[model samples]
Target: MNWDSDELRAAALKLLLLATLRETKVAAPLLAELEELGMVAPGTRKGEFRLLAQQEDKFRRYLSVRWPEFAETEQAFSARPTLISAIALRALRRAPLKLPAGITQLNRKTWSAWAGAHSKSGCATPPPGILLTSDENLRLRPNAGLQIIGEQGGTLDADVCRALFGELIVPERGFSRNWHVTGVLPWLVLTVENIGAYIDITIPPWLLLVHAPGRNTLLATRFIDRLPATVPWVHFGDLDPAGLDIALSMRGPQTGRTPVPWIPHIAFELLETHSLPLSSPWPTQHLPQKLLEHPVLAWLIAHQRWLEHESIVVLSGLVEDVTKLAEMLRER
Candidate 1:
């Protein structure tokens, strides 16, 4: 599409601001800065030069009209590792509404801010830092280094703590492995534990989100990089195929998470009766064979399309199960 010279100039300025700098600036002077840098090619028309001469409120609409076709902020952020004032990123990600009315809306703006804040070159890969955790007392800063939650660590700003992680903390995962000790019965909640109580008995990430990093153990990412693999665990997820999948993922060879079915086969039967899997695609690949090998899980996977722990009836159920799981840990 043919863009007026001012529009092109405005577009160029945006690229420069997002690519090189983290914030926005008024036009005219910013354009002068661009001209000095040779970003403005010599042949562009004087009418295009009007971009440098125009006020933001006037030219802003022109840019807004071209937003979908031109904005590359999200793409830009995906290309790098960035640092941002902790507060800003949080505000943008959770804000009920994004900003700017058009052009770079809140989502794009936030993502762009992240890109600029991160602004790393392609060759250098950035690692995901811990975002937030339960336990209001806990805090982790990029430069301050890692804080093993249960281990002796430094203090965090209380305000930042509640803001980042929610005030009421749910264990930060939806997928997890459930296990049973020799004496533990099927219907009862089983528990897993690390030395003290790292992640008592929570769902692993993979069961819910795709491509979660299971801990580097027999269990899934749930146990990755942790010092204690022997935590007593409890089974408190839903009574369905998906929960079983989560339990199964946690168990088996390296990531030894076990499947301890709480309301075993109840959801599986309900799902099959409702003809679930027949309605949707079944997960054939990466379906935890070990957890499936458990008589109950196998039957459900074969009959149903999907089931999740969330389908479980009670929220308090997890708390009760966790306590039981922890009690079992104290026994060990």
Candidate 2:
């Protein structure tokens, strides 16, 4: 869904502004989410669509008029403040469209000026914060620090590292003849495509480790410094242009080593073998200059084939491939 369509962008922006007015509490939206809602689709030919840049401008003006104090005046539409506002607004509007047991809830105004606003009565009671979704309230608050979410922290399991890291690790404490201490520690960083996957999936731990960090640990930025210098931080995400771009952005310009793809081989194979089911023709365009040099990205662009992380997860050979890749990286 090219959410950056004029209607969607304007609706998103208005929704964002409405969230701020109501003071929705949540972590800001991630850049990928913002891009999904704003940027042109990948492989789009030059001058395909003029873009909703004009609509965005109008929305910004409306925001400035409606809430000048919180309006964004910047080139990056997904500025922190704007995203945070959007998160808050989404948190407030999460009520299901209809009640359970065949009750109907009508939204007469589909494209309303605001969310959770009523001229006559205002919003109903706000729901508890715990019920908010990641789009509304993400759990990636680094300040909260890192803690194991699944299993218990004693030793780090090899499978856990394989799943979370590309099997990047070095022992934090040296081994002993009588007993190895702390087992193997994770050296790589993982950035999941969806927060739900990050939270819901239970990474079963192999009992071989002397001390395994729980399978479901909430990874945070504050823990990066603890990793070994040799361990390259990698991102696991969709095999699409946007996902690749997100990984590059996370690595920034400073990392000495490229963040290896968690499943580039699979992605390459998918591109070579499968066809995307789209309702309409996608615009044909040359790959972006920055991405052209990358072999995996180049292939995807050349074929105009894109794969979502969810799809990859369900592939028959995913687990085996993931484990094999982990071993390969570990040896490297």
Candidate 3:
């Protein structure tokens, strides 16, 4: 059965719970945290319930009575995969988990795919309208085809945010042979390297999409020259510590625009909160040097690390705080 299918949901949930248990003990406190983050939720706690255990009878009893062929946890994890409950951590840190017989390869590739496919962490599936279409290349398009459901300052949720990273969305007007530059970007540009290197069937090292290497200066001087005084140019790339650092670096003297949050905070908060099985662990140090000088970012630099999309999701709240950060820095 497919990982996302109803038939596999119970197995996935059991696996996630079991995996988390390897590290921590599953109990009420952990269950409370999971509920807050929308991990695994059940009715009022009565007596000592078998949360997660190897006892076959105990495990079966809890499922048979409380959850019938579980299918709801996936939806919970899908929207908020980073909401790591104690149960999850407990399961993961426990005994080594084996992916059933013949399902051997627990390689990075498998883990990455599983995280993307399962609601246990990250998005359940890629967002709609964001496609690997056109010369069959990955493209980041506008918010043309996505359905905005959330009422936050941003409507695009984590899934939508992930989907639209570097993939093109809206096609074009007049049906002209075209490439789309979504949003009123300040000065973001795309360049092709090793272009035309793949003529025959050999795949080239050239990726369909990547962050513009240099900061606003080189990026502006070279590919995109003109820009309005006040513009929001989001630099989207892979969701990693390096990606967050790069976004953080593209600020200050670069664009001259007071760094508003153009990235998403929801992504990182969920990633950390859920303690999702990482393809790569979130970096302890990822903020740019200049940002590291700021007290708020410096604090994040000190011990906490924000993941991708956090800046964008939390931008509105951050603008007012920038002044506070400056004040604190000045005192220092």
Most accurate candidate by TM-score: 2
Q: Report, for every candidate in turn, its global Cα lDDT versus the true structure.
A: 0.36, 0.39, 0.35
1-332: candidate 1 lDDT, tens digit per residue? 33333334343434433333222343444456555744443224442332233333333444456544224333333343243223333333445553334332222233445433332311222124322122111111111111223223433332243346522122333212132112111222232222112222232211111122222223223433132344333343443545444555465444554544344333343454443344655565765454556554566556655444433322334445444544555576
Model 1 clash tally?
Answer: 39
Using TM-score, rank the candidates from best to worst: 2, 1, 3
- TM-score between model 2 and native: 0.35
**Model 3 per-residue lDDT tens digits across residues 143-171:** 22322232333443323553545233222
Candidate 3 stretches greater than 4 Å from native:
1-232, 236-240, 245-288, 308-332
Q: Candidate 3 has what TM-score? A: 0.23
Better of 1 and 2 by TM-score: 2
TM-scores for all candidates?
0.31, 0.35, 0.23
As a whole number from 0 to 100, the lDDT of residue 314 in candidate 3 is 33
